[model samples]
Target chain A: MSKPLILVTNDDGITAPGIRKLISIVNEIGDVIVVAPNSPQSGKGHAITINSTLSFEELNLDGPQRDFSCSGTPVDCVKMALDKILPRKPDLVVSGINHGANSSINVIYSGTMSAAVEAGVEGLQAIGFSLSDLKWDADFDQAEEFIKEIILKTLENPMPKGIVLNVNIPKLPKEDIKGIKVCKQANAKWEESFDERTNPHGTKYYWLTGYFNNMDESEDADETALANGYISIVPVKFDLTAYEYMNELNSVYQ
Target chain B: MSKPLILVTNDDGITAPGIRKLISIVNEIGDVIVVAPNSPQSGKGHAITINSTLSFEELNLDGPQRDFSCSGTPVDCVKMALDKILPRKPDLVVSGINHGANSSINVIYSGTMSAAVEAGVEGLQAIGFSLSDLKWDADFDQAEEFIKEIILKTLENPMPKGIVLNVNIPKLPKEDIKGIKVCKQANAKWEESFDERTNPHGTKYYWLTGYFNNMDESEDADETALANGYISIVPVKFDLTAYEYMNELNSVYQ
Candidate 1:
């Protein structure tokens, strides 16, 4: 039996505490290869570098870990690692320990989830992990056991093709943590209010600011699971086909 | 009755002929305001600018259009337009005469579609328009009538709340075109094959490239509609709740 090859990456640059923690965890489970953006690519969804040339440099940043920092989006890092750097197909790909939550609609805007989604598109078992806390020094000690368990479970029982797990952990002490809950993404959204500002030239511009509004009171929602002190695990599929509305729309088109 | 205020934008910078044609189409229909990226932001999906300052300059380009080239993503341009530029809430938001198709799963990574999705999130009626071809010299004349018809129809009859249209026009003569088909996004995806290359330092990197593989043979799909020379309009909503799978997974979690 061979050791599982684990490809690790994140939206928060390669040296961020989040991916460092992720790399440390995966190192115990499998052969770890880290390819992440040189700078933070937080909200850069599935963006690829079309106009720019991608560059990567192998770093001797840590002990026994192979790391490469790339000048591209999170999706680019995954593509580069899988298609250029890695000698063979990785058994699994994991993104994040992202600084912010990618639990609900934020998944669409998250570079962390996009890395996992990119791997899922390539038929690899993938998972994206995030903490509800956005603090730079946020503790990930509580999530270690569950994350490792989930990764091992995913490796033992592979995920469905094109599906990835989006796991959001609540910020809590290891003992205070509730068990994991498999749930659906809550029907929630970011209610945006752009903060108006003046440029140096006295011209007006805006900065995007928003409050996350979780309107779903459903018992099985990821938001509810997290609020109730449970680690929320949502099996997210990349196929954006609104299957239920198909028949109704087909009738209209016909 | 007062003229409806139409906010226009695109993923292809404000200079693209496609958007110019779109602005011209809507100018006749309503009072139009154009706010788009200064550069192409093709695959930047639902991303927002947080790490950097954004700027928008009113361009003095020669045309009937009032354009502002912004230093941000498509979603940013929309927020800036609504919050800092437009005096009041726009009656409708129309994004793109995109240089490429945003049909099927591509909608998840599309900046053109993101602009419209952002508008829809802000509780405004929005539509994203795309052409099948990616040519800078692609014919825009053939798109006028169909664009007008769809936009007028959309304005006349409101779409469901939180729903935004991801409309893809076949790059054929408008007369040869079959009527509009309200379709669902096909189960289609990009089969990514990265073009690996060695840099000046002899280190290898990868350029992400892929071909679209259609998995759905259903006649009601956007891919099917587009292939049949019909304009495919898939009403896309951002709420990613896989409701049916919730209860089933909840039992396992419990």
Candidate 2:
């Protein structure tokens, strides 16, 4: 049987340790092609470059996988790869061993998960992996075996169309990990407290700063699972419709 | 009783005619404040400017409403408005008399809808309005009464938290247009066909272009409603968890 083909990408720039680690692991499982943004695109959720042109070039990175760096957002990298780079439709598209958690409401703001969602929208099996730690050199090794296991399992069982997995691993040693839990997205949000500052020209500017507020206490909440030392897998869908509220909304419009 | 504090914003930048029309209509309904991007941010879905500092300056536009143009994406405008600009939490947040359609799958890539989703995430009553026409000079006046009615109705009945309205108006004259229909987001996607070309420097570049492929035949779909010349109101939620698939996904993981 032919090996599974995997497309690798991330929100972090092409040189980030997270994507490198992900590429290394996927290489053993599939014929890999890495198409990632040339610049860091954290927090750039689902953004596509419409007003400008996109350019990409092949990179001589040390890897068994072929690497191409593109000047666009993470979602753009996925689109570009599928359109211009990949030889054919990949068996699986995996985005990130991201440096931070995308466990709850953070999923909407995450470039990592957005790439995965974009792939899902394209009718491909995809997953986004994130670690709870947010450091550049974060310990991605801790979740290596778990990531490998998840990928292998997913390859065996293709995800439903319009659905993708958002897998967030806890920042712990492999031995300390409490295994995987499929959970719902927890209700959480960032409370923005912009740091107002003045530039050298004395014009006031603001730095975006905020703290995460987790409000879900349910046992099946992804945040709770992560807090309990389990790797959290949220089966996320791109259909944003609130089907339950349709009847109520109809009355309002009437 | 005090007037409703209506916050107005858009992805088409502050000076667009679409927003000017929106501001004019909103001014008559409430004490309005406009906080929108300084430049067009179309297709910049849910992006926040985390890596860079943001700046906003008050613009003396011809209106009764106070206007501020922020140097960021549509989501940033909402955050900045809530944190620094608005005197209090707004009674309602309305984004876009957008110069394009944001119905169905377009909502995922829409700056207009992202601003509304951001407001919804912050637990505000929010609605994103868009027209099917993509021209800057599109006839926004055609649906003024409908837009006003929708806003008034939403204020009377606040949206449930984590939910917002994605309202797309058909490009028809008010008289020819059928009344509103509460609907589900249609299953549709963009078939990307990159317009590849060479720059002056002989480097290959590509412009993102695509045709909308609406695969939905259901009568209750937002796209179907729009096609029938009726305004479509899709209740959109940000909680992306595919709850129905959790059990199936769990079995795979195990």
Query: How large is the C-alpha RMSD of every model relative to the true structure?
Result: 2.3, 0.7
Interface RMSD for candidates 1 onward, in order: 2.4, 0.7
Each candidate's DockQ score against the native complex?
0.51, 0.92
The top-ranked prediction according to lDDT is 2
Q: Note the residue pairs that clash in candidate 2.
A: none
**Cα-based TM-score, every candidate:** 0.93, 0.99
lDDT (Cα, tens digit) per residue for candidate 1, span B71-179: 9999989988987788799988999899989998889889999999889877899999999999998998897888898888778777676788889999888888988
Clashing pairs in 1: none
Candidate 1 lands at a TM-score of 0.93
- Which ten-residue region of model 1 chain A has the weakest summed lDDT? A245-254
Against the true structure, candidate 2 reaches a TM-score of 0.99
Give the clash count for model 1: 0
